[model samples]
Target: MSILVYAEHDNKNLKTETNKTVTAALKIGGDVHVLVAGTNCQSVAEQAAKITGVNKVLVADNAAYEHQLAENVSALVLEIAADYDTIMATALTTGKNFMPRVAALLDVAQISDIIDVESADTFVRPIYAGNAIATVKSLDTKKVLTVRATAFDAAGSDNSAEIVTLSNVTDAGISSHVKDELTVSARPDLGAASIVISGGRGMQNGDNFKLLDGIADKLGAAIGASRAAVDAGFVPNDMQVGQTGKIVAPDLYIAVGISGAIQHLAGMKDSKVIVAINKDPEAPIFQVADYGLEADLFDALPELEAKL
Candidate 1:
Protein backbone atom coordinates (compact mmCIF):
# COMPACT_ATOMS: atom_id res chain seq x y z
CA MET A 1 0.00 0.00 0.00
CA SER A 2 1.05 3.59 -0.61
CA ILE A 3 0.27 6.40 1.85
CA LEU A 4 0.07 10.13 1.29
CA VAL A 5 0.67 11.96 4.59
CA TYR A 6 0.01 15.69 4.69
CA ALA A 7 2.97 17.66 6.01
CA GLU A 8 1.80 20.44 8.32
CA HIS A 9 3.92 23.53 8.33
CA ASP A 10 3.98 27.34 8.42
CA ASN A 11 5.91 27.81 5.13
CA LYS A 12 9.24 28.08 6.99
CA ASN A 13 9.69 25.10 9.30
CA LEU A 14 7.90 21.74 9.44
CA LYS A 15 5.65 21.15 12.42
CA THR A 16 6.67 18.36 14.86
CA GLU A 17 3.28 16.75 14.37
CA THR A 18 4.22 15.97 10.76
CA ASN A 19 7.11 13.79 11.87
CA LYS A 20 4.84 11.94 14.29
CA THR A 21 2.21 11.46 11.61
CA VAL A 22 4.86 10.12 9.28
CA THR A 23 5.77 7.57 11.93
CA ALA A 24 2.14 6.46 12.00
CA ALA A 25 2.11 6.22 8.23
CA LEU A 26 5.23 4.08 8.31
CA LYS A 27 3.57 1.78 10.83
CA ILE A 28 0.75 1.16 8.41
CA GLY A 29 3.28 -0.56 6.13
CA GLY A 30 3.62 1.53 2.98
CA ASP A 31 5.75 3.78 0.82
CA VAL A 32 5.17 7.03 2.72
CA HIS A 33 4.98 10.19 0.57
CA VAL A 34 4.58 13.55 2.35
CA LEU A 35 2.49 16.27 0.71
CA VAL A 36 3.75 19.76 1.54
CA ALA A 37 1.06 22.21 0.38
CA GLY A 38 1.84 25.88 0.92
CA THR A 39 3.16 28.98 -0.78
CA ASN A 40 6.97 29.47 -0.72
CA CYS A 41 7.20 26.19 1.17
CA GLN A 42 10.16 24.65 -0.65
CA SER A 43 12.06 24.76 2.64
CA VAL A 44 9.25 22.85 4.32
CA ALA A 45 9.35 20.22 1.58
CA GLU A 46 13.12 19.90 2.02
CA GLN A 47 12.61 19.31 5.73
CA ALA A 48 9.98 16.64 5.00
CA ALA A 49 12.30 14.94 2.51
CA LYS A 50 14.68 14.26 5.40
CA ILE A 51 12.17 12.25 7.44
CA THR A 52 13.50 8.71 8.03
CA GLY A 53 10.73 6.67 6.38
CA VAL A 54 9.51 9.03 3.68
CA ASN A 55 9.79 7.72 0.13
CA LYS A 56 9.03 10.99 -1.63
CA VAL A 57 8.07 14.62 -0.95
CA LEU A 58 5.31 16.19 -3.04
CA VAL A 59 5.30 19.99 -3.15
CA ALA A 60 2.26 22.02 -4.20
CA ASP A 61 3.48 25.61 -3.95
CA ASN A 62 0.91 28.24 -4.86
CA ALA A 63 -0.75 31.28 -3.34
CA ALA A 64 -4.09 29.45 -3.09
CA TYR A 65 -2.45 27.03 -0.63
CA GLU A 66 -0.51 29.71 1.27
CA HIS A 67 -2.94 29.78 4.17
CA GLN A 68 -3.93 26.10 3.67
CA LEU A 69 -7.63 26.90 3.54
CA ALA A 70 -9.71 23.71 3.71
CA GLU A 71 -11.48 24.35 0.44
CA ASN A 72 -8.28 24.82 -1.54
CA VAL A 73 -6.13 22.14 0.09
CA SER A 74 -8.84 19.47 -0.03
CA ALA A 75 -9.45 20.20 -3.67
CA LEU A 76 -5.73 19.84 -4.34
CA VAL A 77 -5.59 16.51 -2.48
CA LEU A 78 -8.50 15.16 -4.50
CA GLU A 79 -6.75 15.93 -7.76
CA ILE A 80 -4.13 13.29 -6.95
CA ALA A 81 -6.16 11.04 -4.62
CA ALA A 82 -6.53 8.25 -7.12
CA ASP A 83 -2.91 7.13 -6.84
CA TYR A 84 -2.69 6.55 -3.10
CA ASP A 85 -4.29 3.67 -1.21
CA THR A 86 -4.47 5.65 2.06
CA ILE A 87 -4.40 9.36 2.83
CA MET A 88 -3.73 10.64 6.33
CA ALA A 89 -2.67 13.67 8.33
CA THR A 90 -2.12 14.58 11.96
CA ALA A 91 -5.22 15.39 13.96
CA LEU A 92 -4.46 19.10 14.14
CA THR A 93 -6.68 22.11 13.46
CA THR A 94 -5.60 22.19 9.81
CA GLY A 95 -6.03 18.46 9.23
CA LYS A 96 -9.45 18.44 10.92
CA ASN A 97 -10.58 21.29 8.70
CA PHE A 98 -9.77 19.73 5.32
CA MET A 99 -9.67 15.89 5.62
CA PRO A 100 -13.43 15.62 6.13
CA ARG A 101 -14.08 17.48 2.92
CA VAL A 102 -11.78 15.08 1.09
CA ALA A 103 -13.64 12.13 2.57
CA ALA A 104 -17.03 13.55 1.66
CA LEU A 105 -15.91 14.28 -1.88
CA LEU A 106 -14.59 10.74 -2.26
CA ASP A 107 -17.77 9.26 -0.81
CA VAL A 108 -15.92 7.24 1.81
CA ALA A 109 -15.72 6.98 5.60
CA GLN A 110 -13.19 9.21 7.31
CA ILE A 111 -11.60 7.71 10.40
CA SER A 112 -10.83 10.41 12.96
CA ASP A 113 -8.12 10.62 15.62
CA ILE A 114 -6.83 7.06 15.15
CA ILE A 115 -4.40 6.12 17.92
CA ASP A 116 -3.31 2.75 16.57
CA VAL A 117 -3.20 1.02 13.22
CA GLU A 118 -4.22 -2.56 13.86
CA SER A 119 -3.98 -3.02 10.09
CA ALA A 120 -4.23 -1.00 6.91
CA ASP A 121 -8.01 -1.38 7.08
CA THR A 122 -8.62 -1.62 10.84
CA PHE A 123 -7.79 1.09 13.41
CA VAL A 124 -8.22 2.00 17.08
CA ARG A 125 -9.55 5.38 18.12
CA PRO A 126 -10.85 7.12 21.21
CA ILE A 127 -14.54 7.79 21.59
CA TYR A 128 -17.03 9.32 24.04
CA ALA A 129 -14.58 11.87 25.47
CA GLY A 130 -11.90 9.15 25.50
CA ASN A 131 -13.92 7.11 27.96
CA ALA A 132 -13.97 4.22 25.47
CA ILE A 133 -11.76 2.79 22.72
CA ALA A 134 -13.40 1.88 19.42
CA THR A 135 -11.86 -0.52 16.94
CA VAL A 136 -13.20 0.17 13.47
CA LYS A 137 -12.67 -1.55 10.14
CA SER A 138 -13.15 0.50 7.02
CA LEU A 139 -14.37 -1.09 3.81
CA ASP A 140 -13.54 1.80 1.52
CA THR A 141 -10.98 1.26 -1.22
CA LYS A 142 -9.28 4.53 -0.34
CA LYS A 143 -8.64 4.98 3.38
CA VAL A 144 -8.78 8.47 4.91
CA LEU A 145 -7.48 8.87 8.43
CA THR A 146 -6.37 11.42 11.01
CA VAL A 147 -3.63 10.23 13.32
CA ARG A 148 -3.20 11.32 16.94
CA ALA A 149 0.42 12.49 17.02
CA THR A 150 0.98 11.93 20.75
CA ALA A 151 0.36 8.20 20.45
CA PHE A 152 3.38 7.55 18.26
CA ASP A 153 7.08 8.38 18.33
CA ALA A 154 8.33 10.92 15.80
CA ALA A 155 10.19 9.67 12.75
CA GLY A 156 13.85 10.68 12.59
CA SER A 157 15.51 12.85 9.93
CA ASP A 158 18.34 10.86 8.36
CA ASN A 159 17.53 10.22 4.73
CA SER A 160 16.85 12.43 1.74
CA ALA A 161 13.84 11.47 -0.30
CA GLU A 162 12.95 12.41 -3.87
CA ILE A 163 11.13 15.76 -4.05
CA VAL A 164 8.41 15.95 -6.71
CA THR A 165 6.81 19.32 -7.51
CA LEU A 166 3.26 19.22 -8.81
CA SER A 167 1.85 21.86 -11.17
CA ASN A 168 -1.79 20.73 -10.85
CA VAL A 169 -3.16 23.20 -8.32
CA THR A 170 -6.65 24.08 -7.05
CA ASP A 171 -7.90 27.53 -6.16
CA ALA A 172 -11.23 27.47 -4.36
CA GLY A 173 -12.31 31.09 -4.37
CA ILE A 174 -15.21 30.26 -2.06
CA SER A 175 -13.01 31.02 0.98
CA SER A 176 -10.28 33.62 1.18
CA HIS A 177 -7.31 34.01 3.51
CA VAL A 178 -7.77 36.48 6.33
CA LYS A 179 -5.39 37.89 8.89
CA ASP A 180 -4.22 35.56 11.62
CA GLU A 181 -4.01 36.61 15.26
CA LEU A 182 -1.52 34.27 16.90
CA THR A 183 -0.42 33.98 20.51
CA VAL A 184 3.28 34.68 20.89
CA SER A 185 4.95 32.90 23.78
CA ALA A 186 8.53 32.32 24.92
CA ARG A 187 7.74 28.96 26.49
CA PRO A 188 7.80 25.71 24.51
CA ASP A 189 4.73 24.79 22.47
CA LEU A 190 2.13 22.99 24.58
CA GLY A 191 1.79 20.00 22.24
CA ALA A 192 5.54 19.42 21.83
CA ALA A 193 6.72 20.26 25.38
CA SER A 194 8.37 17.50 27.42
CA ILE A 195 6.94 18.90 30.62
CA VAL A 196 3.71 20.89 31.03
CA ILE A 197 2.21 22.78 33.95
CA SER A 198 -1.48 23.64 33.68
CA GLY A 199 -3.96 25.66 35.75
CA GLY A 200 -7.74 25.54 35.97
CA ARG A 201 -10.79 27.39 37.36
CA GLY A 202 -9.41 26.82 40.84
CA MET A 203 -6.75 29.37 39.94
CA GLN A 204 -9.37 31.98 40.90
CA ASN A 205 -8.22 34.64 38.41
CA GLY A 206 -5.85 35.31 35.55
CA ASP A 207 -3.29 36.97 37.84
CA ASN A 208 -2.99 33.73 39.80
CA PHE A 209 -1.63 32.00 36.69
CA LYS A 210 1.63 33.72 37.54
CA LEU A 211 2.03 31.06 40.21
CA LEU A 212 2.68 28.53 37.48
CA ASP A 213 4.96 30.89 35.58
CA GLY A 214 7.81 30.57 38.03
CA ILE A 215 7.52 26.81 38.09
CA ALA A 216 7.27 26.61 34.31
CA ASP A 217 10.35 28.80 33.90
CA LYS A 218 12.33 26.76 36.40
CA LEU A 219 11.53 23.53 34.56
CA GLY A 220 11.48 25.03 31.07
CA ALA A 221 7.98 23.66 30.65
CA ALA A 222 4.96 24.84 28.68
CA ILE A 223 1.89 26.24 30.41
CA GLY A 224 -1.60 24.93 29.67
CA ALA A 225 -5.08 25.56 31.05
CA SER A 226 -8.22 23.49 31.41
CA ARG A 227 -11.40 24.49 29.57
CA ALA A 228 -12.71 25.86 32.86
CA ALA A 229 -9.86 28.32 33.18
CA VAL A 230 -10.35 29.57 29.62
CA ASP A 231 -14.12 29.80 30.03
CA ALA A 232 -13.67 31.76 33.27
CA GLY A 233 -11.45 34.23 31.36
CA PHE A 234 -8.36 33.28 33.34
CA VAL A 235 -6.48 32.68 30.12
CA PRO A 236 -6.86 32.68 26.33
CA ASN A 237 -8.43 29.76 24.50
CA ASP A 238 -5.03 28.90 23.02
CA MET A 239 -3.85 27.77 26.47
CA GLN A 240 -6.75 25.40 26.95
CA VAL A 241 -6.16 21.58 26.85
CA GLY A 242 -9.07 19.15 26.71
CA GLN A 243 -11.29 17.12 24.43
CA THR A 244 -12.40 20.24 22.56
CA GLY A 245 -8.87 21.65 22.82
CA LYS A 246 -5.34 20.48 22.09
CA ILE A 247 -4.19 16.99 23.05
CA VAL A 248 -0.86 16.63 24.85
CA ALA A 249 1.18 13.67 26.11
CA PRO A 250 4.05 15.30 27.92
CA ASP A 251 6.56 13.35 29.97
CA LEU A 252 5.54 15.25 33.09
CA TYR A 253 2.16 16.99 33.48
CA ILE A 254 1.55 19.03 36.63
CA ALA A 255 -2.04 20.07 37.21
CA VAL A 256 -2.46 22.86 39.75
CA GLY A 257 -5.84 23.94 41.07
CA ILE A 258 -7.52 21.87 38.35
CA SER A 259 -10.37 19.51 38.95
CA GLY A 260 -10.02 16.62 36.54
CA ALA A 261 -13.09 16.63 34.38
CA ILE A 262 -13.45 13.92 31.73
CA GLN A 263 -13.00 16.49 29.00
CA HIS A 264 -9.70 17.63 30.53
CA LEU A 265 -8.56 14.06 31.13
CA ALA A 266 -9.12 13.19 27.47
CA GLY A 267 -6.40 15.69 26.62
CA MET A 268 -3.62 14.94 29.13
CA LYS A 269 -4.42 11.52 30.63
CA ASP A 270 -1.77 10.03 28.36
CA SER A 271 1.01 12.01 30.04
CA LYS A 272 3.82 9.75 31.26
CA VAL A 273 3.84 11.16 34.81
CA ILE A 274 0.76 13.04 36.01
CA VAL A 275 0.80 15.15 39.18
CA ALA A 276 -2.44 16.59 40.49
CA ILE A 277 -2.60 19.24 43.23
CA ASN A 278 -6.03 20.01 44.53
CA LYS A 279 -7.55 20.58 47.96
CA ASP A 280 -10.55 18.43 47.18
CA PRO A 281 -9.59 14.78 47.65
CA GLU A 282 -12.30 13.55 45.32
CA ALA A 283 -11.37 15.62 42.27
CA PRO A 284 -11.42 13.10 39.42
CA ILE A 285 -7.96 14.21 38.27
CA PHE A 286 -6.35 12.37 41.19
CA GLN A 287 -7.76 9.12 39.86
CA VAL A 288 -5.44 9.27 36.82
CA ALA A 289 -2.53 11.07 38.45
CA ASP A 290 0.57 9.06 39.21
CA TYR A 291 1.21 11.45 42.10
CA GLY A 292 -1.70 13.14 43.82
CA LEU A 293 -1.23 16.01 46.26
CA GLU A 294 -4.18 17.10 48.33
CA ALA A 295 -3.47 20.66 49.43
CA ASP A 296 -4.57 24.26 49.02
CA LEU A 297 -2.99 25.59 45.80
CA PHE A 298 -2.54 28.97 47.53
CA ASP A 299 -0.06 27.43 49.97
CA ALA A 300 1.22 24.74 47.62
CA LEU A 301 2.13 27.12 44.81
CA PRO A 302 4.53 29.21 46.88
CA GLU A 303 6.19 26.19 48.45
CA LEU A 304 6.55 24.38 45.15
CA GLU A 305 7.98 27.45 43.43
CA ALA A 306 10.54 27.94 46.19
CA LYS A 307 11.53 24.29 46.15
CA LEU A 308 11.96 24.33 42.37
Candidate 2:
Protein backbone atom coordinates (compact mmCIF):
# COMPACT_ATOMS: atom_id res chain seq x y z
CA MET A 1 0.00 0.00 0.00
CA SER A 2 1.23 3.47 -0.84
CA ILE A 3 1.67 5.82 2.12
CA LEU A 4 1.83 9.56 2.72
CA VAL A 5 3.75 10.93 5.73
CA TYR A 6 3.29 14.42 7.10
CA ALA A 7 6.71 16.10 7.16
CA GLU A 8 6.70 18.33 10.24
CA HIS A 9 9.22 21.15 10.19
CA ASP A 10 9.95 24.73 11.16
CA ASN A 11 10.89 27.22 8.44
CA LYS A 12 14.57 26.36 8.89
CA ASN A 13 15.03 22.67 9.77
CA LEU A 14 13.04 19.45 9.73
CA LYS A 15 12.28 18.11 13.17
CA THR A 16 14.20 14.90 14.05
CA GLU A 17 10.94 13.03 14.74
CA THR A 18 10.03 13.11 11.03
CA ASN A 19 12.96 10.84 10.22
CA LYS A 20 11.77 8.19 12.66
CA THR A 21 8.22 8.35 11.33
CA VAL A 22 9.63 7.83 7.85
CA THR A 23 11.33 4.70 9.18
CA ALA A 24 7.94 3.43 10.38
CA ALA A 25 6.42 4.21 6.98
CA LEU A 26 9.05 2.04 5.31
CA LYS A 27 7.80 -0.96 7.30
CA ILE A 28 4.33 -0.55 5.71
CA GLY A 29 6.05 -1.71 2.50
CA GLY A 30 5.36 0.58 -0.49
CA ASP A 31 6.28 3.76 -2.27
CA VAL A 32 6.33 6.36 0.52
CA HIS A 33 5.72 10.06 -0.18
CA VAL A 34 6.09 12.90 2.31
CA LEU A 35 3.92 16.00 2.31
CA VAL A 36 5.80 19.18 3.25
CA ALA A 37 3.23 21.89 3.99
CA GLY A 38 4.57 25.24 5.05
CA THR A 39 5.56 28.66 3.71
CA ASN A 40 8.98 28.98 2.02
CA CYS A 41 9.56 25.34 2.82
CA GLN A 42 11.31 24.30 -0.39
CA SER A 43 14.30 23.49 1.78
CA VAL A 44 12.12 21.24 3.91
CA ALA A 45 10.78 19.52 0.80
CA GLU A 46 14.27 19.03 -0.55
CA GLN A 47 15.39 17.53 2.74
CA ALA A 48 12.46 15.11 2.80
CA ALA A 49 13.21 14.00 -0.75
CA LYS A 50 16.59 12.71 0.37
CA ILE A 51 15.22 10.37 3.06
CA THR A 52 16.31 6.82 2.14
CA GLY A 53 12.92 5.12 1.74
CA VAL A 54 10.94 8.05 0.30
CA ASN A 55 10.12 7.93 -3.42
CA LYS A 56 8.75 11.47 -3.67
CA VAL A 57 8.31 14.65 -1.63
CA LEU A 58 5.08 16.63 -2.13
CA VAL A 59 5.38 20.33 -1.45
CA ALA A 60 2.40 22.57 -0.63
CA ASP A 61 4.02 25.96 -0.16
CA ASN A 62 1.37 28.39 1.03
CA ALA A 63 0.92 31.11 3.63
CA ALA A 64 -2.14 29.35 5.09
CA TYR A 65 -0.07 26.31 6.09
CA GLU A 66 2.95 28.21 7.42
CA HIS A 67 2.22 27.39 11.03
CA GLN A 68 0.54 24.01 10.35
CA LEU A 69 -2.84 25.18 11.62
CA ALA A 70 -4.95 22.07 12.20
CA GLU A 71 -7.89 23.20 10.04
CA ASN A 72 -5.85 23.93 6.90
CA VAL A 73 -3.44 21.03 7.40
CA SER A 74 -6.31 18.61 7.86
CA ALA A 75 -7.98 20.00 4.73
CA LEU A 76 -4.76 19.79 2.72
CA VAL A 77 -4.14 16.17 3.76
CA LEU A 78 -7.77 15.21 3.09
CA GLU A 79 -7.55 16.57 -0.44
CA ILE A 80 -4.99 13.90 -1.29
CA ALA A 81 -6.17 11.07 0.98
CA ALA A 82 -7.93 9.19 -1.79
CA ASP A 83 -4.71 8.04 -3.51
CA TYR A 84 -2.92 6.49 -0.56
CA ASP A 85 -4.02 3.43 1.37
CA THR A 86 -2.20 4.54 4.53
CA ILE A 87 -1.39 7.99 5.90
CA MET A 88 0.87 8.42 8.92
CA ALA A 89 2.93 10.97 10.83
CA THR A 90 5.11 11.10 13.92
CA ALA A 91 3.05 11.18 17.15
CA LEU A 92 4.39 14.57 18.17
CA THR A 93 2.48 17.74 18.99
CA THR A 94 2.07 18.57 15.31
CA GLY A 95 0.81 15.13 14.35
CA LYS A 96 -1.39 14.83 17.43
CA ASN A 97 -2.97 18.17 16.52
CA PHE A 98 -4.09 17.32 12.98
CA MET A 99 -4.15 13.53 12.38
CA PRO A 100 -7.54 13.10 14.08
CA ARG A 101 -9.00 15.91 12.01
CA VAL A 102 -7.74 14.30 8.82
CA ALA A 103 -9.07 10.93 9.93
CA ALA A 104 -12.47 12.43 10.76
CA LEU A 105 -12.59 14.25 7.43
CA LEU A 106 -11.84 10.97 5.68
CA ASP A 107 -14.49 9.23 7.81
CA VAL A 108 -12.10 6.64 9.30
CA ALA A 109 -10.94 5.80 12.80
CA GLN A 110 -7.42 7.01 13.54
CA ILE A 111 -4.86 4.63 15.05
CA SER A 112 -2.90 6.63 17.58
CA ASP A 113 0.71 6.22 18.80
CA ILE A 114 1.39 2.93 17.06
CA ILE A 115 4.75 1.55 18.22
CA ASP A 116 5.05 -1.46 15.93
CA VAL A 117 3.72 -2.36 12.50
CA GLU A 118 3.15 -6.14 12.53
CA SER A 119 1.60 -5.71 9.10
CA ALA A 120 -0.05 -3.07 6.93
CA ASP A 121 -3.34 -3.86 8.67
CA THR A 122 -2.20 -4.99 12.14
CA PHE A 123 -0.29 -2.72 14.54
CA VAL A 124 0.97 -2.58 18.13
CA ARG A 125 0.34 0.40 20.36
CA PRO A 126 0.45 1.41 24.01
CA ILE A 127 -2.66 1.73 26.13
CA TYR A 128 -3.28 3.07 29.66
CA ALA A 129 -0.31 5.37 29.89
CA GLY A 130 1.95 2.63 28.48
CA ASN A 131 1.06 0.27 31.29
CA ALA A 132 -0.02 -2.25 28.67
CA ILE A 133 0.38 -2.85 24.94
CA ALA A 134 -2.47 -3.57 22.58
CA THR A 135 -2.16 -5.18 19.18
CA VAL A 136 -4.99 -3.84 17.04
CA LYS A 137 -6.06 -4.76 13.56
CA SER A 138 -7.87 -1.98 11.72
CA LEU A 139 -10.44 -2.89 9.07
CA ASP A 140 -10.58 0.63 7.66
CA THR A 141 -9.94 0.86 3.93
CA LYS A 142 -7.81 3.96 4.34
CA LYS A 143 -5.64 3.40 7.42
CA VAL A 144 -4.53 6.53 9.27
CA LEU A 145 -1.89 6.37 11.99
CA THR A 146 0.43 8.38 14.21
CA VAL A 147 3.63 6.46 15.04
CA ARG A 148 5.56 6.67 18.28
CA ALA A 149 8.93 7.74 16.86
CA THR A 150 11.14 6.24 19.57
CA ALA A 151 10.23 2.68 18.55
CA PHE A 152 11.75 3.04 15.09
CA ASP A 153 15.22 3.89 13.90
CA ALA A 154 15.38 7.20 12.05
CA ALA A 155 15.67 7.21 8.25
CA GLY A 156 18.81 8.76 6.85
CA SER A 157 18.97 11.50 4.19
CA ASP A 158 21.40 9.78 1.82
CA ASN A 159 19.13 9.08 -1.14
CA SER A 160 17.97 11.28 -4.02
CA ALA A 161 14.27 11.32 -4.91
CA GLU A 162 11.80 13.36 -6.96
CA ILE A 163 10.12 16.48 -5.52
CA VAL A 164 6.59 17.29 -6.69
CA THR A 165 4.82 20.57 -5.94
CA LEU A 166 1.13 20.30 -5.03
CA SER A 167 -1.24 22.80 -6.62
CA ASN A 168 -4.73 24.23 -5.95
CA VAL A 169 -4.18 23.85 -2.20
CA THR A 170 -7.31 24.63 -0.20
CA ASP A 171 -7.31 27.01 2.74
CA ALA A 172 -9.93 26.45 5.45
CA GLY A 173 -9.40 30.05 6.68
CA ILE A 174 -10.36 28.97 10.19
CA SER A 175 -7.03 29.70 11.89
CA SER A 176 -4.05 32.06 11.68
CA HIS A 177 -0.55 32.35 13.08
CA VAL A 178 0.01 35.01 15.74
CA LYS A 179 3.43 34.60 17.35
CA ASP A 180 5.82 31.89 18.57
CA GLU A 181 7.81 31.95 21.79
CA LEU A 182 10.49 29.25 21.84
CA THR A 183 12.72 28.09 24.70
CA VAL A 184 16.35 28.17 23.63
CA SER A 185 18.83 25.76 25.22
CA ALA A 186 22.37 24.86 24.28
CA ARG A 187 22.02 21.30 25.64
CA PRO A 188 20.96 18.54 23.26
CA ASP A 189 17.19 18.45 22.74
CA LEU A 190 15.73 16.21 25.46
CA GLY A 191 13.66 14.19 23.02
CA ALA A 192 16.54 13.67 20.57
CA ALA A 193 19.46 13.23 22.93
CA SER A 194 21.27 9.91 23.20
CA ILE A 195 21.82 10.48 26.94
CA VAL A 196 19.61 12.34 29.42
CA ILE A 197 20.29 13.31 33.05
CA SER A 198 17.19 14.18 35.02
CA GLY A 199 16.40 15.48 38.51
CA GLY A 200 13.33 15.33 40.75
CA ARG A 201 11.90 16.54 44.09
CA GLY A 202 14.87 14.99 45.84
CA MET A 203 16.92 17.69 44.19
CA GLN A 204 15.44 19.95 46.87
CA ASN A 205 15.84 23.47 45.37
CA GLY A 206 16.52 25.17 42.06
CA ASP A 207 20.08 26.05 42.98
CA ASN A 208 20.69 22.43 43.92
CA PHE A 209 19.94 21.54 40.30
CA LYS A 210 23.29 23.04 39.43
CA LEU A 211 24.66 19.69 40.70
CA LEU A 212 23.48 18.06 37.49
CA ASP A 213 24.80 20.63 35.02
CA GLY A 214 28.45 19.67 35.32
CA ILE A 215 27.77 15.96 34.91
CA ALA A 216 25.45 16.67 31.99
CA ASP A 217 28.09 18.78 30.27
CA LYS A 218 30.72 16.10 30.69
CA LEU A 219 28.40 13.49 29.21
CA GLY A 220 26.93 15.80 26.57
CA ALA A 221 23.49 14.89 27.80
CA ALA A 222 20.26 16.84 27.91
CA ILE A 223 18.95 17.86 31.34
CA GLY A 224 15.44 16.78 32.25
CA ALA A 225 13.34 17.22 35.40
CA SER A 226 10.53 15.32 37.06
CA ARG A 227 7.11 16.98 37.52
CA ALA A 228 8.04 17.60 41.15
CA ALA A 229 11.15 19.59 40.24
CA VAL A 230 9.24 21.65 37.71
CA ASP A 231 6.33 22.14 40.13
CA ALA A 232 8.80 23.18 42.80
CA GLY A 233 10.10 25.85 40.37
CA PHE A 234 13.49 24.18 39.82
CA VAL A 235 13.03 24.25 36.07
CA PRO A 236 10.60 25.01 33.26
CA ASN A 237 7.67 22.76 32.40
CA ASP A 238 9.29 21.86 29.08
CA MET A 239 12.03 20.11 31.05
CA GLN A 240 9.56 17.85 32.81
CA VAL A 241 9.67 14.17 31.82
CA GLY A 242 6.59 12.12 32.73
CA GLN A 243 3.32 10.71 31.43
CA THR A 244 1.82 14.19 31.03
CA GLY A 245 4.98 15.49 29.36
CA LYS A 246 7.29 14.32 26.60
CA ILE A 247 7.97 10.57 26.29
CA VAL A 248 11.58 9.81 25.49
CA ALA A 249 13.62 6.64 24.93
CA PRO A 250 17.24 7.60 25.14
CA ASP A 251 20.19 5.19 24.97
CA LEU A 252 21.35 6.16 28.43
CA TYR A 253 19.06 7.70 31.04
CA ILE A 254 20.49 8.79 34.39
CA ALA A 255 17.94 9.64 37.09
CA VAL A 256 19.57 11.56 39.92
CA GLY A 257 17.80 12.39 43.17
CA ILE A 258 14.53 11.28 41.57
CA SER A 259 12.26 8.81 43.29
CA GLY A 260 10.77 6.98 40.36
CA ALA A 261 7.06 7.64 40.48
CA ILE A 262 4.74 5.69 38.15
CA GLN A 263 4.01 8.83 36.13
CA HIS A 264 7.75 9.41 35.74
CA LEU A 265 8.48 5.80 34.83
CA ALA A 266 5.90 6.01 32.06
CA GLY A 267 8.22 8.42 30.28
CA MET A 268 11.69 6.85 30.71
CA LYS A 269 11.12 3.15 31.36
CA ASP A 270 11.88 2.40 27.72
CA SER A 271 15.36 3.86 27.99
CA LYS A 272 18.03 1.39 26.88
CA VAL A 273 20.38 1.74 29.83
CA ILE A 274 18.78 3.21 32.92
CA VAL A 275 20.89 4.39 35.89
CA ALA A 276 19.21 5.43 39.10
CA ILE A 277 21.01 7.23 41.94
CA ASN A 278 19.02 7.67 45.11
CA LYS A 279 19.74 7.21 48.79
CA ASP A 280 16.50 5.32 49.35
CA PRO A 281 16.94 1.72 48.26
CA GLU A 282 13.26 1.09 47.71
CA ALA A 283 12.55 3.89 45.22
CA PRO A 284 10.45 2.49 42.39
CA ILE A 285 13.04 3.77 39.93
CA PHE A 286 15.42 1.07 41.17
CA GLN A 287 13.03 -1.71 40.21
CA VAL A 288 13.46 -0.98 36.49
CA ALA A 289 16.98 0.41 36.65
CA ASP A 290 19.78 -1.38 34.86
CA TYR A 291 22.31 0.03 37.31
CA GLY A 292 21.09 1.25 40.68
CA LEU A 293 23.31 3.30 43.01
CA GLU A 294 22.18 3.78 46.56
CA ALA A 295 23.83 7.03 47.57
CA ASP A 296 23.05 10.65 48.20
CA LEU A 297 23.04 12.52 44.88
CA PHE A 298 25.14 15.35 46.30
CA ASP A 299 28.02 12.93 46.83
CA ALA A 300 27.31 10.81 43.76
CA LEU A 301 27.12 13.84 41.48
CA PRO A 302 30.64 14.89 42.28
CA GLU A 303 31.93 11.34 41.90
CA LEU A 304 30.28 10.96 38.51
CA GLU A 305 31.60 14.28 37.31
CA ALA A 306 35.13 13.33 38.35
CA LYS A 307 34.93 9.91 36.68
CA LEU A 308 33.20 10.96 33.47
Best by TM-score: 1
Clashes of each: 0, 0
Local distance difference test scores for all models? 0.96, 0.91
Instruction: Give the per-residue lDDT of model 1 (tens digit) for 13-130.
Output: 9998999999889888989999999999999999999999999999999999999999999999999999899999999999999999999999999999999999999999999989
Positional deviation of 88 in candidate 1, in angstroms?
Answer: 0.3
Candidate 1: RMSD to truth: 0.8
TM-score for each candidate, following the candidate numbering:
0.98, 0.96
The superposed Cα distance between candidate 2 and the true structure at residue 112, in angstroms, equals 0.7
Pick the lDDT winner: 1
Single out the weakest 10-residue window by summed lDDT for candidate 2. Answer: 168-177
Query: Which pairs clash in model 1?
Result: none
Candidate 2 wrong stretches, greater than 4 Å: none
